[model samples]
Target chain A: MNPTLDKLLGGKQGAIGLAVLAALILVVFPLLLDAFRLNMVGKYLTYAFVAVGLVLCWGYGGILSLGQGIFFGLGGYCMAMFLKLEASDPESTKIQSTPGIPDFMDWNQITELPMLWQPFHSFGFTLLAVIAVPVLLALVIGLTMFKRRVGDVYFSIVTQAIALILTVLIIGQQGYTGGVNGITDLKTLMGWDIRTDEAKLILYFVSAFLLFGCILLARFIIASKLGRLLLAMRDKEERVRFSGYDVASFKIFVFCVGAAFSAIGGAMFTLQVGFMSPSFVGIVPSIEMVIFAAVGGRLSLLGAVYGALLVNFGKTYFSESFPELWLYLMGGLFIAVVMYFPNGLAGLWDSHGKRWLTRIKPKANAPVKTEPVAKPVAKAAPTPELETTP
Target chain B: MEWLSEFGAIAAMQGFNGLSVFCVLLLMALGLAIIFGQMGVINMAHGEFLTIGAYTTFVVSSLTEQYAPAFGPYYFFFAIVLSFLIAGAIGWLVEWAMISKLYQRPLDTLLATWGLSLVMQQTFRSIFGAREVSATLPEWLMGSWNPTETIDIPRNGLFVMGLTILLTAIIFLMLYRSRWGLQVRATMQNRVMSRAVGINTKRVDRMTFALGCGVAGVAGAAFTTIGSTGPTAGSLYIVDTFLVVVFGGAASLFGTIASAFSIAQAQSIMEFFMSGSMAKVLTLSAVILILMMRPQGLFSIKVRK
Candidate 1:
């Protein structure tokens, strides 16, 4: 019985344990927290989804996509459109409170909704669009950019430019896309009162579940043969291309996957918050997502989640407590994180944990040799890369 | 005959507006081009420097209104100089403390500077509320000149154009003629070789960054005369600034000037017919198309492998 227990707690058993722990945390967290706090946590977890995508693309794929916000915004707007349609009077197809149409559309006198917005009226279609739109856009962009071999700073500039353009586009199409004010004051989702405690809890649970599922999927991909190919491409793009692999295709695949993840995050974000706007897809939000991944440590999926939580929690706290000083704190944190903890919070854990334990128990040093066997392989791989490279 | 004359007059007015936009774009892009082209850092906080300058100008105007009415129109000039210094000092400090450390990782600098930009924006927002501040332009700067009864050109816009030319000449001389300029160029071209030759590459980097930021501040000061000043005014210039830098090809002042002229003209001309947002969309679409056709931009510098 002891031997069976040991086996269950060893090797792949540890990963299973971590997964179970994560699942438990996700499932039980909202139950403990109040509705307001749970909603906020849900938003942060949605951001984590975007950060996780960034970790895969920017962290591992060596592609600095500054337009993840564009995907996030697209997903959000999609969901918002459907929710707005759902909440509207069925016969009139317009909410009486929102005169003519959305505020932006009032100026243009767009009394009739555009043909494209028709699909969004359905909950199921809107849900599909929340995933589909960002992925489709990312696929197109990735295909063009990677196929042309636009990497490094050039890719960064192009993506940033794309984000700016998208923001402008959304803002300009105020009739359909709610200009700068964005779509807000959403009261219901598929006949459920979104403002109620029960609905908020449900949304929180969905976000947590989606986050966990994404982490698992990301882990699976990272561990697969395709994941190895991605790492090889990141490490040596030319070599990978020379080895008969379609580097562009691989990049596009990863980029699309990342975009899909970000879209799911965005969908969850809008549903929880009951709002969507052009601000979500702006350059600032995009940069913020990248920073979350960077400060958390890009190499590990867990790092992305941790970074999003830490940075966002800091944002909420600072913005609420010391609004003026928040920017300074954020800047200082960015500089400190980059200079001191390039590997992020996870790196700090790996570096200091052993020493801390040793200091606490000097007599336990006999088992020092056995400690290496228990360490995650992911933590070990990065050390060689750091030493060998810059 | 009357309709033809009216069309001609409208065309001329738009041409002047295009030139005005070009002047602002040129000033903003020159600084970005120097940083991105010379040193491979895309200083995302470049626009925030502009904001600082604008705010400084606003404060100067307020101070002059309250305490020193005698300073009058010249107060704008004083604000411009002070803004340059203030922005430059901050830029230098940032370069020395944070940016200098991240030279090995250019992309990381993008994120760091972005964070810095946000902080600056929020700081400004907290200090000056979210509403747009009316930057008081002296009567002399506010009025327009009527070359003909039908053709009225803004006096301040003309000032901006003249300033653009003067600043361009000054920057050209400073970059090419000065000894420090040579050292900066040397470091920009090859850091290892410059170090081997006993050049203070670190000092050059800080100075260059500060100088670029100073130029951006000046652009912002110049901008207040034409546009509204606010906490998020910097965001308006960000896209145009990047477009100018990327389209001009990084590192080349000549390319920046050329791209700024072309893109600004294209945007203004399109704006004459279409809505402002549509015009921006058209302009960006043109830039993307251009980039697709010429990935290296109009002027590609020779990079040593």
Candidate 2:
């Protein structure tokens, strides 16, 4: 490997993990899997976005948000709104009472476009909103909760309520939000028919590229000096505060970042799945997203993606064959994961796989190991879950 | 004069509706308050245990009506006791197998119990089928009483309220006035010290959990009077039940009851004017706001952080 490329990859393990993930997602999956299976993988990758976000928020920052689906849903809805507007042009909607509004709104007897849906008519605005909406919500929530030092279980519960509230609000305001069925019949993006097989294949690559870009961006953030603070704050927040840091801002920042990541995933989900709905924006899905992060190894960004895919894969297969057995298996999986494997998949890899990586390439051995970055993460390992990672 | 009477009748009905809702919530919260307040173990599966009580009632109700029609009218009392014992036994097994090792980790307990809830729900679906079931009530539980030509109340509502009150009084007496209460309280405050003083805190923990679950079972029994039983019924109520306990102050029995009363009443009254979902959305929003404003909840006891 080139010296510059080696430095870019950080270590031998990092490079190998990157190659395997990239090849599988970009080349192997698309080649081996049919269009239907590829679309399914695309759908699963959308969840990987949430899992990665969870790795930052819960695994690193010690904030377990059970409402990530809200942000993901918001992002997806923003994109869906744009697509729906394009599909529901006056020419296409002439059969409805209203000639310009969405079919659902027209069906529900909404004569004109609602105030909120108007902005979504602009693709540029929708693009901005896909990231902005969730980040803004997280900002307010984090500022309110973290400033008051309401955290851990309280934070988790409050997030769950937010998810519950959002779902109820959407279902209740069906004329505006598309209700329990959600914003569906999304057909195109900027006159390009997203419903076509070729377009879906393109969308798959676009999402795959975007996901890898996010992984790189997250890695950049995690490798910084600020990343060290997140680890410190997770374990000994008092010491960090006593050491004279504004803890609330850091907490808020990581949460916002996580929200942004989830939003991106949600947007991609709508593009690939061809719909955005309340089914993805609730407590059950949100908690399931956390389990994805947890199973992937909360501490490892790469592991989160695999975790999401694996869990969803298992779910799809199991529910198909034995619907009655699915809940028991899923329930038992949660218990088993929590009880036995606190460190998750990545942590398991680190214990065993890291040694092999070092053996294969001696240059991956680092002077960074001499520093204090290693200690706080070990301390952050609570009784049931978590393990140190650097 | 007619309009005034009409208004009074509506108010009277809504008040009973609220009171019935309050009774259900209080019965659920009381059990939660005991376990959560004393041990600080958040049981996400508490709702499932409540389902256990409900299904037990359903089974007994069906059996008596089918096998012995003469006993159908009187089998409810027997069903309640059976509900308590079955739910309590499950609680004991759960405590021994799962919760005992997870005492030091509250959040993990939440996750594990959640898993347990899923398993319990699945078990119910497999055993009873997925559709909702209701018990055959005795003839005495039939009909409504009219205080005046304009005002009326369901007999079942009043019966449930009566049952709730009886259970509450019994629980309060047992938990506060008895020697066992002293031991439990002692263990709750200082586990190590209580053990040093020969309190057998472990036994207290198991008994406390069993008692809390047993109470939840009775709540489930009372629930059969007003609502049908389904596998997911417990789940539908779990979040609201947790809110009642937390908003009332996790450790305070009176607070739990007070909070439950206010929430239930608010929901019932709002339900008359708004969509049921909207009413729930508003109530939950208010509760969340209150909790954020006073993170300790409405009636929190001062303890060293």
lDDT of 2 by residue, B51-113 (tens): 999999999999998899999778999999999999999898889888888887676777788
Q: Per-residue lDDT for A247 in model 1? A: 95
Interface RMSD of 2: 1.1
All DockQ scores: 0.47, 0.68
**In every candidate, what fraction of the native interface contacts is reproduced?**
0.39, 0.59
Q: Write the per-residue lDDT of candidate 2 for residues A254-343, one digit (tens) a residue.
A: 999999999999999999999999999998899899889878988888999999999999999999999999999989988887888877
TM-score of chain B of each: 0.96, 0.97
- For candidate 2, the per-residue lDDT at A375 reads 53
Q: lDDT tens string, model 1, B68-158? A: 9988868988988998999999999989878998998877888778777877888889899988886789989978898878889989999
Error of 1 at B187 (Å): 2.2
lDDT (Cα atoms) of all candidates against the true structure: 0.82, 0.88
